[model samples]
Target: MRLDEYVDDIEQDDSVALRKLAEEKSYAVTEYIDDARTRFDETLTDDTLVGSTAPSVFVGRSSYPNVSAGVLAPVGDENDAEAYATTGEWYQQGFSIDDVFERRTGLLNSTRRSNVDVYDVWDGFVGTQREVALADDPVDIELGLDDRPGFDLDGPLEDIAAPRGPRAFAESARVTENPSVPRAIEKTLSDDDWRAEGAITYLYRRGFDVYDINNVLSVGALGEAENRRLVPTRWSITAVDDTVGQYLRGTIRNAPPIDRTLVWHTSYMGNDYWVVAAPGDWEFELLELKAPGSIWNPDPDGQLYMAADNEGYDGRSGYVEETSGAYYAARLGVLEALADRDRQAKVFVVRYATEAYWAPVGVWQIRESVRDAFDGEPAVAETFHDAVRQLVPQLPVSMAALRRKSTMAAGVQADLSAFGAGGDSSRSR
Candidate 1:
């Protein structure tokens, strides 16, 4: 028997084929949809507006700002001319890539496996990373007072946004397309590439007291009275060895100076993507307390190609740099990460500082099409100023195109800071 024949109300009842037939008349549907946005026929399995990859807001874990900007502002407000500002006002929010792109199907997918309660953030994080490792049914991460209604107050990982600069890329505002051109970093990692790191086993081996910490992870005992950091009371250390001891790790007892930190996100709202942390993301004020090379800048002139994967942040001290060579050399390492994944290419660098934060920055692309126009090396830049100096005199340079690089650099900076070792300030802006 035909399924349509079994339906009592064709107008009220919908099906996949029937919905496709309806959407065939897109002109009429657009007019009807304008009357009501969420008017999708529940029964229609294929109800969609051409399946876009545009950005969208997540449920229950969105809109969490009012976060202090940095650990210690290097420059205090105008009133304190001498001392750096201890706190900077931040504004951040996040949007999903699925809601932004209509063609977000097999070609570009926003999907992943996650323990996070919110569907969008999980899918968004997984979509960008391709693969992720979640602890079990329950996710981990800390939270703040501003996270009452819209954030994950019960865990340690409260996905949030970044403060927007004068030129920031928020979620296309309401799902937009670049008519001129679209620039993106192509990413492809298969099972062989993203192997399991055995995070649970690794933790126990390092003397991480999971059984003792679960209590702290449970009801989020670390949650603040008002603006307190969200620390869980007791959480089952997923996949721990059976032969575990009842003793606590020395790090927790402060036997040898140890620090505890959390990782989160903050952003300009709606249109921010994920990234690994970098030294430049650290505030100059906090960096002062630590040694010169304590903070690590991910997008150094050399490590530009490597997409920021995650961060290691602490609520107390700032990020610790990868102690190795000269500061700029380490900076170069970060830039080159994404410099030439497969082939060699020239890159430009640019820094932005307008009564806000300032740091080393860059831009780069392969010299494939230009026919050796740049020769073996197009042009190399270490600082933001040097990068802009080379690209600016291009005569008829696409202003919007250049702007995209700046936005991308900003994203790299934000993500690096979000995941770096310090402040763990990923939840708010």
Candidate 2:
């Protein structure tokens, strides 16, 4: 019987035993919902990346030659063979790793909605800036100290140093001289070690399944001299409570006993979405929700929730929250494409996924506005933006944020100078 109905009966007879059971169930259900709210967001790069750790790159070691100014010299093939493969210009993934559509075919396309999405092929790797002569120096022109007439042998080096002509490692942050290259590299270098993990690989790792790391992640990359490498973005979202963990433990149908506190989340949004190696013929993609707080809960808000296998997409046009029409349109954008493509051609890019979509720290206000607006509607499965317009309406489109109010005019967005809930939304937004 429903808890409400059972409670009514207990009330009519004042039965203590019945009351106890209803109360117990009520707590369980609420806790369940909270845990269920917890979800893993890999598309975070699409909407994450804060601080100076931006995705933008400065020109060579010196600001003199802006890297953005198209200075990559033609990458010569090994041995400079005229008929050999030529390295292409460096570029970002067509889409942010965090993106996906609600309906993902094991082999087709995917989308990332309101949730943070991204992938971590390797962890603890750092974003690098090399100390180079040009890659490191400032862009200012240095007129060679107008020929100081004479050379002095009796003077200190400081008196003879002419502002150190064009610093070899000026614009760069980390530089290693040729003599400094570690005499003995503790590790062997290989493109195979840079393998990218897909949904299948993720599951395999989770299941204690072992495989060759290189075979699964990256294949052979361009020659060692190319100096072309990628610095994967690491993402994390936090929540407000322990309820999220509880919910995660019980939410997924057949999950292992969850013990990780969900303080942050790991994204799956990246160069590719799913893994190809897992043997199981189960359902769609491999998106497991993680809680930096507890592997159980997936809600960034901390209200215990479990969103395993759930996919969220930002619902907005470039910046405006996707109006009902746009929301549905975003969904339809994928669904219509999928429907038209029969069984095999289900995969196609609706919007060419770009690194700009993933790296947001340096975006213009307009760009940020769109990203923020779309975050309001985190559901991607509800395609046809028109169909899901109701998901977000007058729901604090501005930064006032969402809070339960006694009346529409109540201070849902007011400062917590006087409070019912705590200050940080992570605790009770």
Candidate 3:
């Protein structure tokens, strides 16, 4: 029977698929680490790292007002420093989870304790770090560390950043060459009266990706000169995503809505994404189901962990608490896709994390997954409720569970008794 016509109770078993993917990922990670170690030089037993290409800068929020401002540079392949920089292009290049880990693990974060205010301070370690962030390409740098850098891979993973590698306290940092600054960025930097939000929107409209904007914003490069202050990299990432997402949302506010309900699906880094776009005014919801053994839900015997957050046509007033950064990342992706089509949608995006998603490789994948979800032809449905019913059995959670967490799902409970009287259904695929 067609999924929308008949309701049934079914549980998906992805154990075999998970096992195969796990084995492949394990092999790839091991091989990548081995290759990296071969190219990585350990001779920096001294406190100085020389001739490294500074690809990015990180501002840590560990101490609040007093932060850890640092530069991120590749240790060995100094010539290819730009590859270590995080960008959405990594997704376009088809970077696997292991590839992301390997790239991030190759760069060392050299930091120095400093106040969050660095808008006018330019001549020291912080200045050098800002220069790297402002540069269009990797800048050659020399870093004098307080001690030998520590390489530890056993720390807890981050949802907003890739697996970072070595770390050290930088006593001094020097830029060896002139970093090329793009004109758009230069213009933003020169505008003393421009607010950060306005500058962010301007940059997005001027063809700057969120990744670059995040980097620049983290170093206190944007905003009115007096109000500019360093922002932590983690905060900057989500901030840029949200800022740009709001811009895209405004761009599509007056556009026509989609004519039909469309469903698209894609998988990346062991997570499966299902995006449903229905004809309506602007609305977005993200529903996440993490398998028991997934990174976020690590207890093998625990129940599935589900989280959801949503916004109406007017947009969210406060931050999304349950889904956090993933909400903004995924929302930005859907909005970008909608903006390109010159249309708006009531977007419901579901992410199912299988046990194979063992590592937390940050929220970039979430953004990329939804952005590319529309690449192929989508399943068409007559109604949004029909689309939800069609995908219910394939989800890890039951229809009831989804309805509990999803406002949109709850609104369509008129046929409750019909859906409640369910029968067993075979796997159609």
Give Cα-based local distance difference scores for all models. Answer: 0.20, 0.19, 0.82
Q: Which ten residues in a row have the lowest lDDT in candidate 3?
A: 420-429
What are the runs in model 2 whose C-alpha is more than 4 Å off?
1-429
Better of 1 and 3 by lDDT: 3
TM-score of 3: 0.90
lDDT of 3 by residue, 281-395 (tens): 9999998989877788877787788889999999999999899999999999999899999999999999988888877878888998888888856777878887887787677
List TM-score per model, in order. 0.20, 0.18, 0.90
List candidate 1 segments past 4 Å from native.
1-39, 42-387, 393-429
Alpha-carbon runs more than 4 Å astray in model 3: 1-18, 21-47, 154-162, 414-429
Every candidate's CA RMSD? 24.6, 23.8, 4.3
lDDT per residue, candidate 2, 111-133, as tens digits? 00111111221211111221111
Question: What is model 1's C-alpha RMSD?
Answer: 24.6
Query: Sort by lDDT, best first: what order?
Result: 3, 1, 2
Clashes of each: 91, 105, 0
Candidate order, TM-score descending: 3, 1, 2
Top candidate (TM-score): 3
